[model samples]
Target: MTEKKDSPSFEETLSELDAIVSEMENGDLPLEVALGKFERGVALSRLGQQSLEQAEQKVKILVNEQGENQLHTLPENEQP
Candidate 1:
């Protein structure tokens, strides 16, 4: 049994998902094992999606200020 870890890194989750895909594609695993892998893959996919959404929310672009570019923070509800 694999021990569950708290808050696995995005890369780790992605790698696990890829491995699950490969295993399923091979078509040699027992139904129980395959179903378990599929379930874990779904969980990892959800976590990855959430991580991406959070990153998108926090994304920012830096502009050079030498000429006239200015930095500003927008309200969360006003983000474009």
Candidate 2:
């Protein structure tokens, strides 16, 4: 069987996006280079959004396990 390649975790994606933003913000890259980085940033942003949406859906499911619509807020210490 061929091994499956895993995508980067949400945190890793955000970290890479942050690095790209910092590099672009330095204002030293040529136009072509900046455009390439911008395109990558846009793709990473979309991936981050999808990750967030998936996490939100999971939270909703766990919170409403019994079919109740109420969402109980977890304690600050319990937050990841």
Q: Which ten residues in a row have the lowest lDDT in candidate 1?
A: 59-68
**Any runs in candidate 2 off by more than 4 Å, and if so which?**
1-4, 72-80
C-alpha TM-score for every candidate: 0.67, 0.78
Query: What are the Cα lDDT values of the candidates?
Result: 0.81, 0.88
Off by over 4 Å in 1: 1-5, 60-80
User: lDDT tens string, model 1, 1-80?
Assistant: 24357889889989989999999999999999999999999999999998887665444222342443555789999999
lDDT of 1: 0.81
Give per-residue lDDT, candidate 2, residue 12: 87
After superposition of all CA atoms, the RMSD between model 1 and the true structure is 9.4
